[model samples]
Target: MKNEVITIDLGSNSFRVLKYDYLNFKIIDEYHQVTGLADGLIDSGIISFEALNRVVEALCIAKDKLNFNPNNAVCVTTAAMRKAKNSNEALEYIVKNSGAKFKIIDAEEEARLTLLAIKYALKREKIDTQNFTLLDIGGGSTELTISFEDKIYTKSFDFGIVTMTQKALKDGKLFEDLRNQEIVIKEFLATLDFSIKDFPFIATAGTPTTIASIKLGYSYFNYDKNVVNGTILDIEDLENSLKLLKEKSLEELVALVGKGRVEYLEIGTYIYKLFFNVLEKSKSIVLDDGLREGVAIDYALSLK
Candidate 1:
């Protein structure tokens, strides 16, 4: 019998659970729910009671629906938990209510896992990973990892779509704040010592995949991962899509981007666009595999 395991990613914007056959390295089933654990965290510096409840509820659903042993599960919480003041208490609440124990991983481990996933993805897709920079834009943090001339470099940024959107809203300068973020990104990239010469820029996570889905004419109900996985997204098309998405109401946007993500999509797109401009890349190869898949892959490698 194949050894099966469950991997859970408690993210800032969403909670994701995956059932995997680790021996074969295949995903059996998966569940995702946008609990927005970092909704007000940028200002508060704490995970709210409502956010804890939402996480507990989502975990409970995963437990009941997935029917996997908690002992055999690898659950990890990311940026939100790392920054939250009450992360311990929040974890206690989740375990007590849903019997799901989650480990809070630091930014370094997070980046390592993300890089591992992307590396696996590129290998599976038969893409050249000789020299590339992978960008993972999450809800509470953005991770940039570069594989240049056989050396791997990584850095995690504090700003993410949820946190950035909250900051912009609080400041009452949505577009202005986003524009300022672009400047900040450019300035930060200038400080990096690595010479990014002819590296193929790769993007993973929700923003790029969501934009790719829209470009492929996929809605929430009809999303095709194979089509979105290796899609090359052009900068010009990204900007045009952002403009069109800005006009969509929550109801209309939900059908395209999924629920709980409608509000963050615009700011996410803005940040996504900034990466292209700052990196001076005309297009990016988008991949759907990320931290959740990374954890599963890491676990499988551990058993070897």
Candidate 2:
């Protein structure tokens, strides 16, 4: 028998599990499910039962796929679980029902892990230390990490696709009015001293990769080949996708893409547009891997 490490990433919009074989240093199995854990948390600060049940079911399914014992697994929840008012309750429920203990990772750790994963996946030994920024946009939060010549500065913002969409709806911001939200986003980025031209950007998470997949003409997302260490996105293609997606209804968007992602697909598209517009950057390197891979790398590093 071989030792394997199970990494479970309980995200705001999805639940993912990855099993890595220690001996081979390779990912053996991966699973994902859309749970939308942050669906209504923007206004209420509490995760709804519907969302909770969905996530729990996803976890149970992931657990069943584990070839190793549950006790050997390490589970962690990110933005969605962290922001929920009843986070402890939700955490307890997962532990009690799923027999999976989860550690709620903080923003700083999230940023650090994201950087680690980028380094590992890209194998960029000599990153342009002078001017480089890494962005990981999740369902409930977005993390920004600015790397200068010698140091890394990081911050986690509450604005994410799901949370942003909920806020926009609550405030009656028209779904089509992406330009109107620029002021709010500009202010948010200003707090971090982020300027679009300050550095080249690297983006992680589903939106960037999905956009990359669309650019490559992938009818269905191919995570392994299309996403991981994927090529940079073309700005014009991204703009075109955003334009096309905006004109779509919920059903239409899902039909074009797939089911379960319609709820946040439009918002995610908007976010991609907003981020690129703010940075004034025409393109970004899309990283298919994010926090879960980061967590695994962090765990591996700790052993050394």
How do the predictions measure up, each by TM-score?
0.94, 0.86
lDDT of 1 at 172: 77
lDDT per residue (tens digit) for residues 181-207 in model 2? 566566656876545475778888877
Clashing pairs in 2: 196-279
As a TM-score, model 2 comes out at: 0.86
Which numbered prediction scores highest in lDDT against the true structure?
1
Residue clash pairs of candidate 1? none
List model 1 lDDT by residue over 1-304, tens digit each. 3588899999999888889889988889898889999988988899998988998888778878988766567999999998899899988888887777899998888988888888888988899768898899999999888887767777788888899889888887877866776777766668768778588999998889888999888887788877898899998768867786768776888888899887888788888887887788988999989998999999999999
